[model samples]
Target: MKHLNSQSFLEDSLKRKVIFLTGKGGVGKTAVAWATALTLSRNKRKVRLISWSPFESFSEPTTLKSLGITWHQLEAAACFKEYALKTLKFEKFFDAVFENRVLKAFIEVAPGLSETVIAGKVWDLFDRGEQDTLVVDLPATGHALSFFKSPMGIEKMFATGFVHRQAGNICDMFVDPYTRVDIVTLPEEMPLVESGQFVEHLMGLGKFHLGFLWLNQCTPDLKVPDKIPSTLDKSIRECLEDHRFRLEREAKNLVEAKKMPLVVKKIPKFSSEAVKETIEQIAAHMEEK
Candidate 1:
């Protein structure tokens, strides 16, 4: 319910060891995640940005290293392999078991194993104290909800074992006050609706510490004089009217977003900037605020 400026919001969010940034697709969640990591690193915090991808290929942006933020791309298979090695305690045994063709295939097709392992790896990082902060760029709303819920499902399914224990630990982190989730979305109809629904869904789960909602790529409101220049062409006048309408729509969506449970922060539209520059600009905006 608080109207927080960017700096204060970032400070408060950093209190949580793990911050998950997620919302509908194409809402600039990854950009916000990178910005947050950069901002935290600039404050001298040891920060790590983790991006979840379902594919085999992974790459870290060189800009992250320049900002002093460690970056990791998490894939389910790799995470599962690491988790198995740690839990099984014998590299040889793990490789023999997980490397088998049929077993590997079965494990891959296992209902919630991948999701469980990914979530567990994140908790492992949080528990290991390897970094001051872990910023996760999660998938879209539906997949993210499933990712966070995987721990509980695994805990119930396993009942008693290392997997159960791991799931339980991750679930504990979920309910911890210091673990927060930030939902990011654009100031438009579909994203706003999904964000509101996502907030309600997280609340219904009764676990996560919903941190805030970010309204990204918001059009700035520009003032127009009552008396317009008569020399202006008709196309220019129409373009100005259209721009004003978009701004008004963005404002209305923002109002609706504020009605949700968490604080809402707006990121002005930066359409022309490259990825790295956009991240830096967002970080600067947070610093200034």
Candidate 2:
């Protein structure tokens, strides 16, 4: 892959309000997401890290916890209860209405209603206006797409009332150009293929701004020795040639990404302990001209 600096693509040196990171599972998306959040926080930006993983807990991974950035694990059940209580607090009449077992049961039974509740809570967080940057460790590509589109989809199904208002507000936040969608991927073939398809799907929606295509765990593009050993077996020589060709192909893809409307970020393969350092490297790359 092309081993260029990260800052080359971040055209705007100013602060970013929101950055969403996503990719296929087990591709280092979460690590990159947390690392990026910490790197931005070091610049004195108020950063919040969120994970939508169903199985994950409120406690962030040790790497992220050590950074001291605010990490939120969004659990649907907890979010629903929090939202319901807040709504009830605001409208005593609603509390009285919900007091009726039938009304409460109806809301619980409604299809897609649970998703709407979660969207409303997410909107409330966005609207609170405290943090400058929100780094979301979103679900896999498909689930993330659904999460983002939840507001709009639910709005259409239930067109009138607070739900509609909440969805409208959330949609505005999403469509903002400053909001960036960062797709994390490995240098391997499958992840890149999925990332490409995800990009295509995002484009088809004509919604949301894609910030960058991040190829993580990239094998560094190292310079070869000046002279090859003549004694090397033919098969070994062919393998070396193939490796070089593959690297060249990756470099071409990076160039193509550079030409796109959004920027592209590349991170080389490193051990987990180096995650923070990697993020710093990424931030430094992004800070470049």
Candidate 3:
């Protein structure tokens, strides 16, 4: 992959209409998303961070309190309420149509419909001109695709009139150029492979405009032989040589930068607070345009 600094790639991505951060679980997508939101807010842009995890609350004020940003949890109850109001606003007729006992019973029983309603609410957020930047802390790999592809799936699964129209409208939000996808990964083998698959899947969706390949927890290069060879037995020398070779393998790949996807490489590891710091670094690079 092309050598990337988070600062530059992030700065460039911010120019797009919508910016999405996604990846397999435990890859730090949420932290990076929060950091992006915080950095954009500090740049004086109106921002909102939305989390879709039902079990975990996104109420950590300390995460962005210093940066003057708020994280909103998209719990089921709140989503249902927001969905009801937004639907009522979209078509005044729905105010009464959705009130029927039969329809209410359907929504109550088929919770999947409730998920569709939440998707509609997300589409509305983009339409309402509420904020300059909207950061979505999406579900992990297994469900993130469903969240983005739900409208299309609903349209196909239920080939009716009203529902089809609604799905079409929701799909429109995703197809717009303002939206894009970013997948986070580690340098290790499995995550890297999964990240590649995520990128390929997003490309298949055709709705994601900007694709970001973020390699997190990267070990900083100890290039140029920074450490002198140790005075040790032959076996230790062989081990050190192996370590040095592994570190420089990718650096050698940089020779053909244009052919590879740009990567935002972060630190190997850090504490929770480091999340913000890493994001800040990314946002700073994103601003370099």
Candidate 4:
């Protein structure tokens, strides 16, 4: 119901301990997450940026260290290992149990075990209070939603045990007011449609707050004269016409975005630059808002 500019959005985000950024694939969710982390870091917050994926492995972004934000790439195997080590309190015991082929095979066969372990790792980060902020560049929409909901699935699947407790803890963190989910989307029909459905799904989960809807790469409004000069070249006029059509389409998408209840922020299309520079530019714009 309320609208927020970049500045207010950043300010509001600073109040949350954890922020999960997600959207359709190739919608620039990672870039927005990096910019949000950098903005918080620049404001003197102790921030950590986490890249989370279920199937694929990831390397930490090199730019994170330069921006003074701690970085971690979350993988199921690594998280499971760390959780096992901590709980068992002995590396030898963990290795013996986990390294056993039968147990390992059973774990691999478990439907949501891997996802639960990864969620536990994220929960541990939040529970430990090691950092002021955690920014999660989550996987795309379907996987991301399942990732967040893994805790609940685990709870139902396991009546009581360490896994169940871990699930409960992660679910608690997820439903807490301090944890926010930010959805990033393009100013296009399919993305907006998916975003709206995702928001409703999150709401259905109950108490999982939808923080912001980021409309990235929005076409900037062009100030053009009502009457085209007869002296203008034909090719130039055609280009102008194309630009006008794009602007019109963007306007319709924006109207649809504004109709949603969540706070919306438009990130302008930036010029091609190095990844670090682009993140910096986005951060600057966030501050300006």
Report, for all candidates in order, the number of backbone clashes.
Answer: 0, 4, 8, 1
lDDT-best of 1 and 4: 4
lDDT of 4: 0.82
What TM-score, computed on C-alpha atoms, does each candidate reach? Answer: 0.91, 0.77, 0.75, 0.92
Candidate with best TM-score = 4
Please estimate how well model 2 matches the true structure, expressed as its whole-model Cα lDDT: 0.68
For 159-224, candidate 1 gives per-residue lDDT tens digits of 887888788788888878777888899999898999988878777776677777888988765775
| Per-residue C-alpha lDDT of model 4 across residues 1-289, encoded as one tens digit per residue | 5423333876787788999899999898988999999899888888988888776754445677777778888877667778878885756644766667776666666878877887788888999989999999889999888887778878788988789877878999887878888899999999999999987887777677777888998777766567767789999888787778888898899999888767888888887667788888888988888
The parts of candidate 2 lying over 4 Å away from their true place are 1-14, 57-61, 90-116, 231-246, 252-261, 271-289
lDDT score, residue 190, model 3? 75
lDDT winner: 4
Query: Where's the lowest-lDDT run of ten residues in candidate 4?
Result: 1-10
Error of 1 at 86 (Å): 1.5
lDDT for each residue of candidate 2 in 142-166, tens digit (9 for 90 to 100): 7777767667677787878666667
Worst 10 residues of 3 by lDDT: 251-260
Question: For candidate 1, what's the RMSD?
Answer: 2.4
Error of 4 at 157 (Å): 0.8
